[model samples]
Each structure stands twice: as C-alpha cells, then as structure tokens.
Target: MLTLLVIFIFVLALTYFVTRWAGSMQKNKMAGSNIQILETMRVTNSKYIQIIKIGSKCFAVAVCKDTMTFLCEVNEDELAYSSDSRVINTEGFKTILEKFKKDKPDN
Candidate 1:
C-alpha cells in the first residue's frame, strides 16, 4: 500500500511539471512568430477590444490594449463543439447588431 502511494505521488508530480513546461514552450514559440494584433474589433468599438492575428495562421479572440483582461490565447484551430460546428442560417452579425441596438440609459 505504501509503495503504491509513493508511485502515485511521483506520477502526479511529473505530470504537473510536464504540463507547465509544455505550456511555456508553446508561448515562447508563438511569441517568436509574427503573431500580430490586426486592426479589428469584433465586439467593442474604438477600443480594439477584439484582435486578429495573421501569421502562420489567423485567429480572432477577445484581447484589448487596456490590459483589463490578461493575455490568453484561444486557438481557433478546430471546432469548439460538434453542435457549434454545424451550419447556421441566421442573419449576419451586422443585421443582428442593428436589430438589438439600444439607446443609452439616462444616468
């Protein structure tokens, strides 16, 4: 029983170290690449709240210059889920935005 427990603990610690090391390597590799923030805002206006990168690949995600949100990369490589990957027949984003436009609340 004691032997099994020690082996389990060692395996857990090795897994933790490997995960952390792999994450750091990916970040540094991508950093060296020309992953630039293109001039586009998907959700917010005038703030560049959304960014685009055109390098070895392109991705769009919620990143801004204000630094309110930390730098986290959401790789748009594959489908997030099986359901979300299916085709959609709804109107385009512009139409939806215009339809939901609201006036500023009188503060």
Candidate 2:
C-alpha cells in the first residue's frame, strides 16, 4: 500500500512538471508566430466571430462548427485606433462578456 502511494505521487508530480514545461514551450512557439487570434466572440453555442491578425493585416471571420467564413478586413482607422488596433484590449473583452452575460438565460 505504501509503495503504491509513493508511485502514485511520483507519477502525479511527473505529470505536473511535464505539463507545465510543455505549456511554456507552446506559449513561446506562439509568441514567435505571425498569425494570432486577437479576439473571439461566440455568436451561438457553436458559432463565433473572430478577429485575427496575420502579419500586418487584420481580418474578421465568422466561425461555425464546420466552417469559417471571411467577413472583412478591418481598418485601423475605424475606431481612431493605431496600428495595434487588431488586438482587442481588456475593455473590449469586458464589454463582450457583459453583452453575453446580459443576453444569457438565468436558468
């Protein structure tokens, strides 16, 4: 019983460290990529609206469970924004969350 407990604990700690290491590696990999998802909003259970930044351009896309439709390329000047306009700020996420929360049923 004691041996089994030791083995279980060892396995758990090994898994924890390995997972943390892999996550850091993945984050580093993504940081060097040219394409990034700036923001995403769920339109329905399986549908979403996403703003993605690829290199110097930004795109808006409608995403469904089985398909992704291109909406348009967003302009930086639309919101009096700078070149980094493609990236959604924390306030934008907060607003989107509030809108969804208000629309969600209490049940």
Candidate 3:
C-alpha cells in the first residue's frame, strides 16, 4: 500500500511539472522578435488604441473585437526614451500622435 501511494505521488508531481513547462513554452512562443507593444488605452469595453513598435519604426492603431485600423506612423525622433534595462519611453503616446499629425502634410 505504501509503495502504491509513493508511485502515485511521483506521477502527480511529474505531470504537474510537465504541464508547467509546456505552459511557459507556449507563452514564450507567443511573443516573437522585434514586435513590442508600447502602450494601450481602452476606448470601450472591447475596443482599444495601441501603440506598437516594429523594429525601429512605430505606429498607432485602433483595435476592436473584429478589426484593427492603422491610424498613423510615428517618428522615432519625436520619442523621449529613458536609457535603462527596460527601455520605456517617457513621452505619452497621445503627444506623439498629435506631433505626427501636425508634421504630416494633408493630401
């Protein structure tokens, strides 16, 4: 009876560890290279405005339940970023969007 209980506990621990490892792997795979979400604001319950940086360039986009709309492209020079391990920008996304609109010529 003791041997059976020990075997069952070992199996349970192994299963738990394997499941944890697989979940961590899935999270790592979901975030790929060079795509960073700088900021996001909730416009509604299911809608948001997001700023994303792809490589050296950045963009502002509107995200809804069924659609994603490109709002504008942001210039890197307009951003004020802190030099740190986790490099986050000090300037607000709204400020950048306004600057971008002013600099962009109307067609």
Candidate 4:
C-alpha cells in the first residue's frame, strides 16, 4: 500500500513539471510573432469572432470548426486595449458586506 501511494505521488509530480515545461516552450515559440490574436469572442460551441493584428493592420475574422472567414478591417484607434491581466476592484469586501446588510429587509 505504501509503495502504491509513493508511485502515485511520483507520477503526479512528473505530470505537473512536464505540463509546465511544455507550456513555457510553447509560449517562447509564439513570442515576437507578426500575427497575433488580440481578442476572441465565442458565438457558439464551435464558432468564434476574433480580432487579430498582422503587421500594423488589425482585422476582425469569424472562425468556425474547419473554416475561417474575414469579416472586416478594424481601426486600432477605436479599440480599448489593456495590458493588465488583473482586474482592479475599487470596492472593498467590508464595504460590500455593509451595503448588503443595509439593503437586507428586517423580518
């Protein structure tokens, strides 16, 4: 029983390290590419609308399971771009909790 548990842990750690290494390699490969996907919105399970930048031009395209169609060229000036991955929450948890309590009806 102890040997089985040890083998399980070893396999789990190996899998985690392998996944992290593969992801880093893939990210490095995609760095400094001319074509980049700016944003993607899913329309259905297999369909998506994407904004992509190639060279200095940006375009909107529709992507399906096996086909991609060009929708139109996009103006970069009109787009709202953010480099930050984290969302800024202006309200604190205590303030939100107090507001919720105030809004609750007394029975």
Top candidate by lDDT: 4
- lDDT tens digits, residues 1-107, model 4? 99999999999999999999998899789986999888899999999999998999999999999999999999978888676523456796899899999999999
Q: Scored by Cα lDDT, where does model 1 land? A: 0.62
- Summarize candidate 3's per-residue lDDT along 39-75 as a digit string, tens digits: 7889999999988889989999999999999999988
Q: Give the per-residue Cα lDDT of candidate 3 at 30.
A: 67
Question: What ranking of all candidate models by lDDT puts the best one first?
Answer: 4, 3, 2, 1
RMSD of 1: 19.7
Residue-by-residue lDDT tens digits, candidate 1, 8-99: 99999999999999988997887676766544445565344544455655454555555445344446564243564344546867886766
TM-score of each: 0.37, 0.68, 0.55, 0.70
* Candidate 2 global CA lDDT score: 0.85
Write down the TM-score for model 1: 0.37
* Residue 39 lDDT (model 3): 73
Model 2, residue pairs in steric clash? none
Per-residue C-alpha lDDT of model 2 across residues 8-45, encoded as one tens digit per residue = 99999999999999988997887789987777889999
Error of 2 at 53 (Å): 1.1
Better model by TM-score, 1 or 2? 2
Rank the models by TM-score, top first.
Answer: 4, 2, 3, 1
Q: What's the lDDT for candidate 4?
A: 0.91
